[model samples]
Target: MQLPGDPRIDAIAEALLADPGDDRDLEAWAGELRISERTITRAFRSSTGLSFAHWRQALRIHRGLAMLAEGLEVHAVSDQLGYGHPSTFIAAFRRVMGTTPGAYADQP
Candidate 1:
């Protein structure tokens, strides 16, 4: 949460939250931030205790959960979140939330 200590990390996090479907990888972020990928990697790990991939996936999972709660269909949420396949989204969701999207959505 506060590990990176670099404003660029914050900017990247904000951008991801705003648009999780952006599938740009670490290199793209490094390029945009005008820093080496290794630098970004170290800063990100120091700040969040998670790699950029994991953190970004977490963000997408949270957003997907929210969208599902709002009555969006599973497939739609998957596509909107840039998952190439519904199963991919489901797998990630299960990994993070310990339940399938449909099951979570069914909870009152």
Candidate 2:
């Protein structure tokens, strides 16, 4: 089904998916699409039913999962995902995924 929202939202989503590790700056993304941050935020919320920040957080968590699956340490994953520290990454991950990276990695 066709979604109703700014087309640029799709573009932004694609860019985020393509480079989940990239720093997520709303203003920069909006500028890239030649739109205002408010418009981007509105479109993102309307299209995905998530605020831009939440979507980015989800993307980061998914990326963190992939990095962990690839055998990267939590510290390395945090650095790669632009987190300031492994503990911060761990907190975010635990908040979203309800488990620590080390525990997740140990699962079969």
Candidate 3:
């Protein structure tokens, strides 16, 4: 479903996906794209069906999954994802993915 004349959102999505862990200011993103923060937020919501924060969390989880698949320990994965602590990473991963990193790592 295309929003009428709203392709800026696509750019926002690309930028987000390209750097999932970046905590850059939304205004910076808007400025970089030459669009308003409202426009960026609106386009992001329209494209992802979730707020930018949630989408970023999901992307972090996806990255965590990849790290697990590559045999990295949870601590390493958490650090790689810029998580403040392993416990924080574990909690976030479990909350979003419904499984702890250990369980996910052990899965066939």
Best by TM-score: 1
Most accurate candidate by lDDT: 1
Lowest lDDT block of 10, candidate 1: 1-10
For model 1, how big is the CA root-mean-square deviation? 2.0
Candidate 2 residue lDDT tens string, 1-108: 123346868776676677666775898887777889998888878877888888877888988898899999999999987788999899999999999989989999
Supply the global lDDT for candidate 3: 0.76
Instruction: Give the alpha carbon lDDT tens digit for every residue of 59-83 in model 3.
Output: 7898889888988999988887768
TM-score of each: 0.89, 0.83, 0.76
Give lDDT: candidate 3, residue 42.
Answer: 78
- Cα lDDT of all candidates, in order? 0.85, 0.82, 0.76
Indicate the worst ten consecutive residues by lDDT in candidate 3: 1-10
Sort by TM-score, best first: what order? 1, 2, 3
Identify the superior model by TM-score, candidate 2 or candidate 3: 2
Q: Give RMSD (Å) of candidate 3 vs. truth.
A: 3.7
Q: Clashes in model 2: which pairs? A: none
| Count of clashing pairs, candidate 3 | 0
Question: How displaced is residue 70 in candidate 1, in Å?
Answer: 0.3
